[model samples]
Target chain A: MRVSELVACTGVPLATVKYYLREGLLMPGEATSATQARYGEEHVRRLGLVKALAGAGLPIPRIRKVLQLIDHPDGSLFEVLGQAIGQLPPYLDIPADPGDYPRARAVLEKLGQIYDPRYVAVAQLERALEALEDAGIPMTEERLDAYGRHIRGIAEVDIGLMPTGSAEDAVRCAVLGTAIYEPVIAAMRRLAHQDIAQNFFQKTDEQDAS
Target chain B: MRVSELVACTGVPLATVKYYLREGLLMPGEATSATQARYGEEHVRRLGLVKALAGAGLPIPRIRKVLQLIDHPDGSLFEVLGQAIGQLPPYLDIPADPGDYPRARAVLEKLGQIYDPRYVAVAQLERALEALEDAGIPMTEERLDAYGRHIRGIAEVDIGLMPTGSAEDAVRCAVLGTAIYEPVIAAMRRLAHQDIAQNFFQKTDEQDAS
Candidate 1:
């Protein structure tokens, strides 16, 4: 397939395809001519995957690393997953309040899950605390633990959706579901809020209406 | 308090505080003297909220819109929540495949959710479908509807966590939770993936290990 065919099939923009090509984010296709390149199935597949990852909110550099992992002969599923977690933008790494760490530890301890402050769960707890603290939205340990328990169920749903094929397939499912489906979760929550907001906020208003 | 004191109190960098002031993101405190300002509690609070929203991956313009909604008198909690949803960065507005929109509609129809094609859920589901399709990951409508049902429960947990106070408080909680705690949700899911990856992916790998 030509570059245009790749774009048509993948639905990625022509300029973006070229950008990926120029940046070496997408490997150059077979050279049909000095000025032209002929893309094939791999290019189309890579193009779609890149678009999906970028849509998942991975930066170009991180996306590149993910693609590299996918391309490498010896890239384990675990390695690709680690890259996905480790390459998160710095904002997610908010420093927790001194008290929250111990509280998170206790929550982990009580839940029978291993506690590592450095783990993603702990980092998430820290950021949640930091944001809550900064906004003056007080969060108690009970509330935090409740969130942990609830989010674990959410995670189970996400993991359950993934295919249990080869390691490559598992990694792809994990990456896309984590990134793309996240908005699906968030968007649904917002919709759910809209669905429920009346009762929560308009109780007195409801009384007046009745 | 002074600007330096604001930095210490909010843990935001001095330069960032100045940038916010220049960008009109942070309303400056009283002008006590040339090159000096007396930032009070409002500045500190706004600074913290800004940091949290940014952490939630809202771009500056969207953050500004969110703050504007928070600040506007008569900004009902509903309006603020709407702003948070409507002003999502373009990346989340991922274009769906030609066939995926109709497929998403079918999924929603079968699930008994009478959502518009223009609705965020439909759009999100379309992207989810597109991502899966592009990568050749098989997804059945039954699977997608199953996800929707489970995700509604997740949304309930999120909404339940919200305070049923005045509109202002609701908006604040919504913004903070949607922004800051979202990472908490995402992070927990990732951590959960790691927790489950053993059983999901490593069953065969474990056999190899033995």
Candidate 2:
């Protein structure tokens, strides 16, 4: 298939395909002649995987590293996924001046997840707490514990889905799911909040009217 | 405090303060003369909120809308949050072609949450399912239901946290948490996967070695 066919079939733009060629993310097709090349099924499959991973929010350079792993015959599937996910930019990049690490550590311990404060996840959680405090919201011990319980539920679901596939096949699934599910889940949460808030607010309005 | 003082006090750069001023996301300080403006406590609070929300991934225009709500006394607290969250760009914006709404609706029905297909949340769910199918992964009803269970847990945490304050006070909390928590939660899930994958892979290695 021609490069244009590749684009038309994959629904990716021509410039992006060219950019991928330049970045060495997608190898050049069979050179039919000067200025023309024929792509194949292999190129099509690779392009699909690349698009899915990129869509999930992985940076181009990191996506390169992941593609390298996917190409390696002996690459551990989980390792590929770990690299894909582990490279995610930290949740919050705030400085340590006013952050309460002791509290964050305590919360992590209470939740049974032992991670260093430097772990991006822990740092991210600390930033959330700090932002809440800065905004005058409390992070009482009881509240943190309750929040932890729910996070554990979400984690279990993510982990549970892991055993469902062989490593190579599952990498794309995880890559896309990681990129996709959060927005879906978060949106659902927002809609759910809207439902609850409407109920509560409606009752308040009625009381006020009375 | 003068404009410089506002910068000094908030720790945000002078250019950012000026940019926010230009964007109208931040109200100008009390002007004693041309090129001289004195900020106050209100400026400090608003600047902090703006920085936190922007850090969370809310765009400038969306931040402007949120700020407008925060300044309006009669703005419903949930409404303020609805806009803040409602403005979140969907994870994937693929055209609705080939997306299985019937499957998505079934998943939602199984989860006991009936939402319209046009709802951003429902549409986001549809996109995720489409990505999974495109990747050749099974979207079994049971798996989605299990995923839903976890999402329900996370949403419960979010809704529980809502009663912490009146709407305005909670807006900053939600803004930061919304901007911050998903990344954090997603990272935690990744970390958890690494842990489990390590265990599974290690056992396999032992079996091979033996």
Return the top candidate by TM-score. Answer: 2
Q: DockQ, per-model, please?
A: 0.38, 0.36
lDDT of 1 by residue, B58-130 (tens): 7888878877777773455655675655555434453345354775666556655534344455576566666
Q: What is the lDDT of residue B10 in candidate 1?
A: 82
Q: Model 1 over residues A180-206: C-alpha lDDT tens digits?
A: 656555655555555566455577577
Distance from true position, residue B135, model 1, in Å?
3.5
Model 2 residue pairs with clashes: none
Candidate 2 per-residue lDDT, tens place, A80-161, comes to 6665554555435533543456555655666666443444555665655665565555466665565556555655566566
Worst 10 residues of 1 chain B by lDDT: B89-98
lDDT for position B82 in model 1 = 57
User: What lDDT tens digits, residue by residue, belong to model 2 across residues B1-210?
Assistant: 888888888889999999999999888788899889888998898898888777667789878877766677345665566656655665445325434466556666676664434445666666666766665554666656665666566656666676556565676666666655665555545445545556666787889899
Candidate 1 segments whose C-alpha is farther than 4 A from its true place: A1-8, A12-43, A54-64, A71-110, A114-125, A138-142, A202-204, B1-7, B12-47, B54-72, B75-77, B84-129, B200-210
The TM-score measured for candidate 2 stands at: 0.75
